[model samples]
Target chain A: MAHLTYFNGRGRGEVIRMMLAAAKIPFTETFLTERQPFEKLIQDGLLPFKQVPLLKIDDMELVQTGAIVRYVAKKGGMYGADDKEATMIDMYYEASRDFYSKFLPVLFMKTEEQAVKDAKAAGEDKYFPALEKRLKETGSGYLLGTSLTMADVGFLEVLLLCVEFGGDDFLDDHSDVKQYYQRLVATPLMAEFLKSPFRKRKNDEQYIKEVKRVLNRE
Target chain B: MAHLTYFNGRGRGEVIRMMLAAAKIPFTETFLTERQPFEKLIQDGLLPFKQVPLLKIDDMELVQTGAIVRYVAKKGGMYGADDKEATMIDMYYEASRDFYSKFLPVLFMKTEEQAVKDAKAAGEDKYFPALEKRLKETGSGYLLGTSLTMADVGFLEVLLLCVEFGGDDFLDDHSDVKQYYQRLVATPLMAEFLKSPFRKRKNDEQYIKEVKRVLNRE
Candidate 1:
């Protein structure tokens, strides 16, 4: 048992959760709503940096989403067994993080136009090309090697987020990324997860719609 | 030979450079001095995400500071050999990244008052305690296992940035973090790194003074 503490939305927490699910790891998720508990957690110093997506493994806790994802990936055997492959997996994961750092801010915007403009300028112009090039270079289809690594899991979520929130057509201009996105969606576990109750929520639809809109615009 | 491409600063590029020095790996440091070249590289689609601190291995390019650090650490044998130990090493490196993310904005600020307020309210109040607790929990003195890992190297740079810019008294309240800083400074390689001509640049001191003045008010 692993426990993840975060808000209800996917955001940073989704990648680790999805990785765990794909790997068949059992974990409990504790979602905090409202400012009171968040403030209380801060005052009590329960959170390392007063941030969420903290992973609790038994008595020890790990903060930082990247670290948490890596920890979980290690447990799930998603990180390569060998050092060289592991390094490549780590590289891809970091690239995904860099991509998220740019696109995440745009998702929080209240209006669709602002999100589109930001995504087009940053997401389409910068992020997609880089990811497309990386995918093409790998030639293995997966972001890391033949099998899906945590990097693929992480990148898939971001691609989903872009289509789910930024708009579906966001990656239309970049064929490799689009193809990669389609391949990721075609995964049995991921496809099943998408069809679950988790994907039917209003917020989820809104995010997906926004992502679709962004894709269409492009 | 490894090649590092970044702006002429210690910023994100320092840890990689330091790791190479510690391991005695000979690598070319390609500093981009002008915006024109930086822009040109991005326009040519050379950069992954159009950012600096990219590591070139043979003909392949890698991005993300965290990913690059781990890759170099593995290559340099700075990361642990065992699975569990490597995970632990990664844990601390991730924590160091968390600390930097919290306090970096303060260092980048133009005014002294804002810098101090940001540090005290954000850095000291939030970041320091978290690091202090981790230091206390480690019990082995070093962040991970008995020997040094890239986590320590990365944290050393971050601590140096905080103290060199904010002042020794900046971490005065957090005894564990303070002791850790002292321990880092005691290392011969680190000490020599500190005294290098790179540390004496006028811009470095100016940035420190500016941030310190802001911290002083708080």
Candidate 2:
């Protein structure tokens, strides 16, 4: 069985978990509530980059969230069909990452008002229009082909965050993305996994405080 | 031939160019001397994320440096031969990125003293030992298999930056990496490519000031 180590929240780790769920891959978890365990993992030399979420699989421990997620996606046959399609899938995945990178930073640095403003601006100016255009252009309801690839998986994750920070009406303006998001969430695999007992909770004040305290950032 | 658009500096644009050189990919470059051309590209919908280092290939415009670099590596046979190898190659590539992200940020915001300290710490504590360990383990002088892969390419790029920021004796203690770096530099393809007239200069004050002025940052 594959194992994952991280905090008990939907930060970077959740996306990997979601990919596992999408692929129906069984995996275990090590949810560290504090910093000591994380430090110990580094001390034990299990983590090359001294970070999590680390995935232990195929007798190798992988760090770097992007590497881990892509590996899982590749192994699960979600990467794409060929080199060109794979590149496109990677491009879309990276596009979502850029959106999340710009949209979510303010949440850690300042007020909710500012965070919302940043999210809206990032979505409106950068991601929303381009993605809507691509989705409409595809007309297949999926980002690439007729089925769900890591491209859609990554986009769904960001879209969920967008709606959370910007509101449901966030996608209301981008009807194509809204319909695509709905279609992805309605997939039987995703629908069931969203309610799984192992599904982690949303990041909250307590979780943030606990993690920051452990990392000595507080 | 593919087309690349970016500033005439080895900042974010160089690595992609290096991968192209390594794979012997024939591509033309559009070196943006000012911000006007960059904004024009974005305005013309050529840049998806409102950024440069965009590559026009396969009749599609690709953004995101990582995606573009990986695509080139994949096409050039530098991305490992299989999925597992590809994952390791990506892990190594990302490790180098992590090193650069930490090592270079200080140059833009603070003193050279602090930048050196951060670069040394980032290299020694994080990248150095792990990479040395892996290199010795592989015994191939490559990050993955017996031949040059994207992992080695990525590391060589960072090692060049590491030498620039840390100095000649930086890799002295890491004997394996030092020798490997020397071997990569001596390669026939790379040796000739390094002297190409099209190679961009390293980032400097004039380039930075020109970019900022054009972008209205000042």
Candidate 3:
């Protein structure tokens, strides 16, 4: 059995959960919602880099969310269609990862509020459109190819986060992305996950407040 | 033929170059030493993310350094010994990539100098020790397994950069990492590359000065 350890929130662990679900793999989860428990886990040497979304399968342990996602994807047969497809998927994944990094400061902002917001706005203008372009270029109803790969799962998470922080119209300028977003959420397991009450429970008040404040430029 | 394009310096492209050399794969390179030429390539739609370290293999063009590194690692048979090994290699690669992300602001620091430098110092203190522990535990003379994989290649790059900025004594507290570093460089093609004058030219004057100043804590 695979065991995933992360915070209660869906911050970085959601993609892993979604991947496992898609593959029909059952796993246990241990959420670290407080500082003390998480610190204890770190002290216990459970985390490699002292970060969460750590996955343990039997005796094998792995860190890094991206790495874990790919590992699970490969195990579940959701990695990509082929080597070229895998490379393309990874390219978009890294690009989305870059977008996530920029979104983080604003999401957790305490200072230079306006500057950070403006930079995020500029980033959205750049990256989101590039993604939209790729969607059109591929025209495979997904990021890389026909089937839903790990890239789309990660990409959907990023898009949802962007919408949370950038407003509903975040991808309105790019019709393809908007449509792609709908198509992604409609994936069988993901769609079920979305409409489930568990989705609502996944929401953290503080997180919502931070995202709203950043979006509203408050 | 594989055509790799980036600036003349190492920045994100060196890892790709190292992987190619280690695999003994011959490829052509196009270096954009100036802003104008690089921008022209971006405008020409050569770069997907408008970023450097773009790899063009045949008709397929891929971006993102991490993705490119993995792609080359796969093609060169340096991906891993197997699926589990690949995941393990990726785990370490992502850890090293995270370390690289923290080291970046300090590398390109122009303001908030002391605060950034101090954070970088704290980061080094935390991550390097963890890496040292891994090296000791694995005891395989390499990061993941007995053979040299992409993880070692990427890890070596990060260590070299850390040493460049934090001085050679950066890894003094971590003898295992120190020994591992020597083992990496002593690889035939890598050693040859290091000895070649081309390595010296790969060093950008601005990069060295910036790194030196940060290490001096000025």
Highest DockQ scorer = 2
* Tens digit of per-residue lDDT, candidate 3, span B9-75: 5667777888877777777887664456666776787776767778888487888988888888888
DockQ of 2: 0.72
Q: Candidate 3 chain B: worst 10 consecutive residues by lDDT?
A: B209-218
When summed lDDT is taken over every stretch of 10 residues in candidate 1 chain B, the lowest stretch is B209-218
Question: Per-residue alpha-carbon lDDT of model 1 for B1-218, expressed as tens digits?
Answer: 88887755666777777776655566787766556666776776767666777778746677667777877788777788775667667766776776666556654555756665565566665667766776778786677766567888878777876776677787888888888889877777667666764332323655444333422421
Q: Model 2: per-residue lDDT, tens digit, A1-218?
A: 89988877777787888888887788999888787887889889888766678899889898888888889888888888887888888888988877777655644545777777777887888787778877777888887878888888888888877777777887887787788888988999888877895667667787788678656688
Candidate number achieving the greatest lDDT relative to the actual structure: 2
Minimal lDDT window, size 10, model 2 chain B: B101-110
**What is the alpha-carbon lDDT of model 3 when measured against the actual structure?**
0.73
Positional deviation of A187 in candidate 1, in angstroms?
0.4
RMSD of each: 7.2, 2.3, 5.7
Using all chains and alpha carbons, the TM-scores for the candidates as numbered come to: 0.82, 0.92, 0.85
Clashing pairs in 3: none
Of candidates 3 and 1, the better by DockQ = 3
lDDT of 3 by residue, A136-180 (tens): 888888777678887787777777776776678767877787888
DockQ, candidate 3, comes to: 0.60
Clashes per candidate (backbone, < 3 Å): 22, 0, 0
